[model samples]
Target: MGGYLPETIVTNDDFTKMVDTSDAWIIERTGIRQRHKVAPGQRTSDLAVEAARVALAAAGRTPEDVDMVIVATTTPDMPFPSTASIVQQKLGTRPCAAFDVQAVCSGFVYALTVADGFVARGIARCVLVIGAEAMSQLLDYTDRGTCILFGDGAGAVVLEPVEGEGTSADRGILGFDLQCDGSKMDLLYVDGGVFEDSNRIGKIRMQGNQVFKHAVHKISEAAENAVIKSNLSMADVDWFIPHQANQRILNGVADKLGLDRDKVISTVAMHANTSAASIPLAWYIGVQDGRVKPGDLVLIEALGGGLTWGAAAIRL
Candidate 1:
């Protein structure tokens, strides 16, 4: 029915001793004042379960009502036990298909798109989709540029079947587009991975300038494409929820799309970039603060490490 984000959080200043960057510098570049990091012993599934509980409660449904669990994250607790399965077990849901979707930061949107199709195609009645991350484990605190840009958090949404007249005014997902550029993989990626690197965790590495450039350009195009696919004009969009990466990237996309600054929903100023968790977290905050409401046309877009980018147009 809607979205949910954790209330607990941590500020950038809290990381001052853990890294070399200052709060002023982080805020100036990323617009992030704080973020929610999982406790040392906290697992990704723990965050997912909490968020799923809130979302299911909001939808007024029990776990048994859910037909699928889709978790979007790059930082799964283990390489073997899918985070979705762990969430399924924790929620005590009836047997249901469960899996994880990995597309880096654009993961949530990608997962949401998949869930939307599942419902629309009559494969599922109710779906619980979660975007959870524990990026703190991947951070190389010594690298200020990358270290300062990420945090840990989770957000979830409940998507139920809704029939529409097959038009842009449809209440559920109206339009969606997903794209990937393998050529840009080197721009933002970890140095190692389980399958290829002997199961060793990799250090986060990024070329901020290049990623920023492509992010602004691709995100703008993806947003426009989604709008067009929905058969609606940009002016019809009431809220633009872009990926919470850098403040500059958000600004550039907003400017290029000709959307009013105020029309953009920004939690990055506080949440930093939770990667997959960013959009849903922003959506949850917007709803909680009364910025998002029923009947509003929302445009969601994201760009991340597979060089993956995606967009969705939804009428709430």
Candidate 2:
């Protein structure tokens, strides 16, 4: 796993200067101290390429060796050619199956789930899975409740098929569950889309209290289903990596599962909520710090814009 955070630092103190918020008020509510932002003219692909290069190198594989590239991002460079294509070209990889998956924040897991299907069926050999987001670009800086909770960053992981006897002991994705409840879309979303507005771009609008009301129950249930599908119990999970939406949400899910709080990997304090990038970014931190190791049973989960939520079990 690999991760990248832009150079520009936007701290809670910075928000006080631009919005009707203070450092103490922000920290007391979200547990976020600071976040990174991309420079002007730096596209989403730039972050994706940076993270992908490092991940490919760490995995000891060349771009030419990859069979597919799946980028999970809500903020793509364009609506036409997927950012995955740009990432493939910049990495000097051959023309292969490349595309994007946008389940909002649940994207990385969705992309990983899709890639695992291809590898399991012998459709691809090595796949590059990336969750890159410039969520700051989508926020209304004046909206402290939303703007203060996002940052710009990217994370990538290289997944290859590992033969197994069809058990929870498998090395790759053992099991996964994907779901969406569009009825609750108003809880969190952007105000515009391709056809909704002539501007074609819009700032994010979130009903914090409403979203919070629904998150814990759906997220906890998804986690439980994934673990049971993998034929394992919560006690068997060595690590808990939840989408870095909020510290409160992370703790809520852990408590629901009766899992140790220390077992959870979190980067929300420094990275804030990088949306789809949060899970992989948190996982990369664990890998680097020696908390996450090979053969560890890991539980991954997220809740995103579509009111989409999912979970997957992996033996990494």
Which candidate comes out best when scored by lDDT? 2
Q: Write one digit per residue (lDDT tens) for candidate 1, span 87-129.
A: 9999999999999999999999999999988998899998999
Instruction: Residues 100-135, candidate 2: write the lDDT tens digits.
Output: 999999999899999999998999989999999999
Regions of model 2 farther than 4 Å from truth: none
Candidate 1, residue 188: CA error in Å?
Answer: 0.8
Q: Candidates' lDDT values, in order?
A: 0.88, 0.92
